[model samples]
Target: MPELPEVEVVRRGLDAHVTGRTITAVEVLNLRAVRRHEPGPADFAGRLAGRSVVAASRRGKYLWLELDGAEAIIAHLGMSGQMLVQPEGVADEKHLRVRVRFADGGPELRFVDQRTFGGLALADMVEAAGAAVPAPVAHIARDPMDPAFDPDAAVTALRRKRTGVKRALLDQTLVSGVGNIYADESLWRTKLHWARPTEKLTRAQAGELLSAATEVMTEALAAGGTSFDALYVNVNGQSGYFERSLAVYGQEGKPCRRCGAEIRRDPFMNRSSYSCPRCQPMPRNPHV
Candidate 1:
């Protein structure tokens, strides 16, 4: 799945290429593409036909195009989903699900999803924290990179969760945008095990963990986000180079940069968790 950095990178791309362009036509090539738009493809295309994209905004892993009215086109890129801006003459990708052409006859925006788990929705706008976000994303907490992300408030919310710190970090209500990959990296940077309880974390450690998440993701964004496969790319189909800098995630049995101990992978919530056993040891006394 595309994480916060990847989504933010795509948001910036949309701001550059799609913002200010009026939607000349919307072709829903697959019904699954607009499955979230309860009103269906006809209504979805009707709503966006003449609307000009005001801005491209994102909160956590969610991205939306702010239209002229109280409506926006929202999107969530599940695993293998991508948003690409290409010239109209370009060949249609095998997974091209939705295409939005512009009146200016410039580049068109395409939504491609190989797995079909990701979809678009035409949602009414709702104000949350004074930001006009699509209704579905109104509840997602601000991310670490968000200027308004209150570290103190996030710590308070996280401590109240009574869950593993990594689980708490993954909780969108407590703190948005920290996915599995970044969570491992952040915990590795903070030298905290994934199983550590959120309540057991000292205030300093909690703050440091959040800051580490911000640091690593900021670097990933600078590198255009960590791309392990061609499925994850920018609007121009450019791949990121941050995967080369990853320390823990997907580095199982590899030497840890700081401790020289081999990195280990463990099953976590049906997925996997990577950590350095020497650096981020499991808690001796776990919270009940």
Candidate 2:
């Protein structure tokens, strides 16, 4: 799952290479991955053939390419999907799932996915751009990175939740773009255990945790988003190096860099959460 930083990097790369280029043709190897006009794949290829890419942008993890006319190309890279600008060659036929060729012939924009979980949709560009798809996710408490972020607001959001802090962080509606890596890093920074209930924190403590969460995410984005599984890559096919700089994530059984306490992992939902036991002490459950 490419998070905010990964998606932002891909969006920037595509904006530089694909914007302003007029589409010469459309090729779809997997129809299930695309949603075309008229609700089928028939007019899809012809409708976008001569249109120019007016702009490119990203909201959350989805990427949008604005066309000169009313149409827009929307893509969700899911988990294993990757977009790259590569020269025309026979090798691309194997991995390339979709391509939008341009009139300039400079390079082909290809969507490649080993898992084939990614998807695409074509619709009114404005509708797609303005889709009721919940911008900035309402439940995300408050983004610590936002200049307007309010710690008081974050404390208020968490003051009543019964779920574990880590689980709360994973809730997209609660805080968009924060996944396992950032949640772990943020909890570790605040010295708050993942298993602790959100309501257990005092307002001051909750504010500290929120601030720490934002700091970790902002720094990670600056480092270009973590990439250890090769699933998250830029439009240019470059992997992020933030994984090399991670403090607790994927460092189980290793000594905590801060306190020398052994790093540990705990199962949460369908995935695992990592942390430093000494740094993030598990608090006792409150009286019912």
TM agreement with the true structure for every prediction: 0.97, 0.82
lDDT of candidates 1 onward, in order = 0.91, 0.74
- What is the lDDT, from 0 to 100, of the residue 52 in candidate 2? 92
Deviation in Å, model 2, residue 199 alpha carbon: 2.4
Q: Candidate 1: lDDT over CA atoms?
A: 0.91
Top candidate by TM-score: 1
Assess the local accuracy of residue 140 in candidate 1 as a C-alpha lDDT between 0 and 100: 97
- TM-score of candidate 1 relative to the true fold: 0.97
**TM-score of candidate 2 on Cα atoms, chains taken together:** 0.82
lDDT (10s digit) by residue, model 1, range 1-288: 489999898899999999999998999999998999998999999878989999899999989998998889999988778999999999999999999999999999999999998999999999888877899998999999888889999988888888788889999988898789999999999999998988789889999999999999999999889887688888778888889999999999999999899999988889998999999998976442
Per-residue CA lDDT of model 2 for 1-288, tens digit only, reads 577677778888899999989999989887766743346664677788988988886655667787776567877777777888888773774556788788998899998877777766676643222242222222233345545555676577676677877776666555556677878888888888888887777888777877777777667678877786777778888898888778898999999999999999987777888989898876787222
- Superposed model 1: Cα runs more than 4 Å off: 285-288
